[model samples]
Target: MSDLLERLRGRGWRLTSQRRVVAEVLDGDHVHLTADEVHSRAVERLPEISRATVYNTLGELVCLGEVLEVATDGRAKRYDPNAHRPHQHLVCSGCGAIRDVHPQGDPLAGLPQGERFGFVLSGAEITYRGLCPECADRG
Candidate 1:
């Protein structure tokens, strides 16, 4: 946590109470939280924190490559804090639950050069959609 704070400070980010609370809420593995969820959790520690502040902090974290913004289903973007490694996502189509998953191979390797269309493709996102165990059992 101190490492993250130091990195943020080195990047010219102001270390405010609201930003600290938001960062604390986002520190963990497999954490995928929406801005509202982040605000709800941050309020538990700092009641004065505003939703806008949480959103702004999240945006800053994303810009710093400290977090990943996942936009699945064209709905609210979920913020993922597992930026230490490259991976993919597995989404529960029924309940909107998300989980980080490692694909069998390099996802980018599947993109052929012909599809590049003379454009340089730097990255790709692969999301596997299926019914989660709980949702599958319910159906």
Candidate 2:
């Protein structure tokens, strides 16, 4: 992904081998990987890449808006690379699988006017939890 590298370079990020491996590991559709998971994948390509470097690169990506960190169960945050569009998450309560789902209506539309509490709200996060098909069939 030359374009991705160019964008990262434009942001004044150092283009190191470890960073490139980390970015490559994260590129793809519907990829939601934890930091440890990303480190594991990146290590396959660059055997000497450290977990700390992976974490740092991931944090930079999140700050750059190239990725989103999602913590569905208050555990280790998962990094989602689908930052090109606004959307929500659907997580399987059983197996911790995650998917993107579009709800029927604008989710923020239901926020009560009184609930504003004299504060300005910029955004909302909605996570729908349910059993994935495989997990549902297993039960």
Q: Tell me, by lDDT, which candidate is best.
A: 1
Question: For candidate 2, what is the TM-score?
Answer: 0.86
lDDT of 1 by residue, 1-139 (tens): 2245555667787777888788888877678889999999999999999888898899989998988899988878998887767788999999999988877887777989898788777777888999999999999
Per-model lDDT? 0.84, 0.82
In candidate 2 the C-alpha lDDT for residue 124 amounts to: 78
What's each prediction's TM-score? 0.87, 0.86
Model 1: lDDT to the true structure: 0.84
